[model samples]
Target: MRGPRRLRLPRTRAGWRRLTQAVAAGCVLALLPPTWLYVTTGGRAGTVAGAPRTDVAVVFGAGLWDGEPSPYLAHRLDAAAALYRAGRIEVVLVTGDNSREDYDEPDAMRTYLVRHGVPDARIVSDYAGFDTWDSCVRAKEVFGVDRAVLISQGFHIRRAVALCRAAGVASYGVGVADRHDVTWYYGAVRELFAAGKAALDVTFEPDPRFLGPKEPGVRRALADAGRRPAAPLPRDAGR
Candidate 1:
């Protein structure tokens, strides 16, 4: 016997309209992560504040020219340089990518800081800060820095803060005027998306490019890594 005819659902104009709206809503829902990050990060956080501060201020990597820092990188360096002069941090950890044949962001960052009056002794360049996550992890394990002042554009500082915290670095936020002068109006839109990605990087386990030998002892690898070299980063970094 033939099975009862299956009834077809209506595909009328209104039904199509409802379906389209539902899909649109789902797309919007998919954007929740970025939206949450954007909504939460406002203005800047505390500036070189009191006691909780420590030995290092990790200046994340930006652009480089052969071995020179990009203009954008210069701004971050200056901000970090200023903090160093103020005695907020005892040392500066410059971390950046050196993946290519000659592009070295960390060394460039260190040189820029030195020219700005920060001494080389006070700077340790990590030639493998593949990203904020790499820098945060290396800072805690390789550099032995338990706390740090994270300098970056205002919109990026919050995400950087979260990433550092997850990596076990007691990260604090310090804003450097964004490379873009003026508010740039709706700039928050892009920043929001960036924050979402930063949020995930916390749990994301990625290896440092040049993690050196002499990693921690068999008994206390946890404590030993805290003294590891700083990790490096890339330019136009999503952080």
Candidate 2:
């Protein structure tokens, strides 16, 4: 059999110009998703002190360290606790991975929040939040979280806010400040690619990794606080 032909570059000037145009177009196309995230989430992200008052606060899991919340995850939980203490949020929906028997992010997050002075009863756990998209979807559908203040690091808050809004949960994002460490840089770079997946999640509106029956955890938590779940608000209401 004949050997495969080697790849060739454009030979003529016109061909080179066309190739350059193609490359430029590809760069723009690749960046469009991240740009969309920033544009759509403009003015929607802020510190915990400025977070909009909402019935629920959704904290996306960062990671666990020795079955405890990692520093990054702890920061997120701390922001949520502050929101609760400031009376900006009522219920806290801690969503994270719990796929394995020993790695339980939601419970770890719940513990961290409780230790931070957030009442145990005000914390609801979503053990199936396998990713940002899953957490946002489950928050709206499974937990009936119509409106929320989403808590995550600054690098991630825009995507979180965009995904939650796409999932029909009116949201404001509380981007917890953190030192610009290696992990923070990694997370910032990672969001560029994650923005593409977020766009697909919005476009396709796929079912979460686990979409179980609607749970009354949020409602019960609200009741425990002597409050009724607020009426669902327009996605752009607080923006």
Candidate 3:
């Protein structure tokens, strides 16, 4: 004899409508954490001029133009350099996508910082910060940074701070004021979904694309900058 008839979900028009509404509600619920993160993190992002000093300032990459930092990236580097010069942060960790041989974001960032008067010795390059998640994960797991100030545009700063914290870095942020032109519009729109993705990433605790042996780069950079490093917490502690 055939097994008991398989159960079937409602297939009528009204049933489908209910199912759709339920799915939509679930999606909204999934977004609430990130939305709350964007709200709560507002107070944490300050200006470079007023930010509290930290062992390092982690500057996330935007993009490059003709082998140089794009205007947005330049703005971030400018803020980081200003902080470094002001002695607000002991070292600068430039993290970004350098997955391709030809395209190098960390190098461009370091070069820009150096040209702006930041000492080369104080700059640490992370060649595998393929995304915000990767950068934060590697910052703790690979570079041995515990506390840091994250630098990025206002629209992107909140999520960066949250992700870095989740990845086990005690983090603050310095928001580079947006130009309020096309770039601001684009960044603001993109941040909505980026925040959601960050929430999911934190919950999942996925490993970074690359995690080599822990190195002394961050500690050495901080020492060179004349600051003793804070003892790092467990990599999975925050999450």
Candidate 4:
């Protein structure tokens, strides 16, 4: 059998220039999504103290530990509870994964928030928020949230804000602070790739994993807080 041909680099000057240009173009293409996220979410993310007063706050699930909210998730819930206690937000929409019977992120998050002083009645659970995009879509479609303050770690908040806005909920983001640990670094790197998926999600505006019938939880929670709920926006109103 003949041996395989050896790989070779471009031999001519013009060929080398073309190769360099191709590499640069590839880099630019890879960077576009993250750049879009940063620019679109500028001035929209801040500490909870500076977050805009919205009727609802949406907390995305991070993970759970021992059937409880993980430290990162607890920090998120803490911000939601603080917003409620400070009268900055009326309802806490805890959106997370509950696809299995044994692991329930939304319930764990709700329990943590309630323990931190948020009333059970004021917290709504979204059992199908399997990801950031799903949470945003469900917040608007199922829960009828026209505007909300999204909560997540700093590395992930810009993408959350971008996706929620794309999903038709006018959103401000409150990025919870955490120690600069290994998980923090991992999350930061993960956002670079997640941004690409986020760009596709906004561009296509696909349906979420689950788009069930509309729920009255958010409207009822607003009513309980003494605000007359505005009519829910049409599904495509954001576009």
Q: TM-scores across all candidates?
A: 0.70, 0.90, 0.83, 0.90
- Pairs that clash in candidate 2: none
Model 1, poorest ten-residue lDDT window?
Answer: 230-239
Native-vs-model 1 lDDT? 0.66
In model 4, the clashing pairs are none
Instruction: Show where candidate 1 strays beyond 4 Å.
Output: 1-27, 35-44, 47-53, 179-193, 208-210, 214-239
* lDDT computed for candidate 4: 0.89
lDDT of 1 by residue, 1-239 (tens): 99999976657999888888999998786677665554443332455443133457888886776567766677778878887677555678888888887788877787788898887767877777887777777877777766667887666677777677667766667766654544433455666666657756654656656567423321142233243443332111222
TM-score of 2: 0.90
Off by over 4 Å in 2: 1-12, 228-239
Q: List, residue by residue over 1-239, the lDDT tens digit for candidate 3.
A: 88899878887999989999999999898678667787756566677776876778899999999999999999999999888788777889999988889999999999999999998999999999999999999999999987888999988888988888889887888899866998789888888778778888988989988888887887887777678544442222343
> What ranking of all candidate models by lDDT puts the best one first?
4, 2, 3, 1
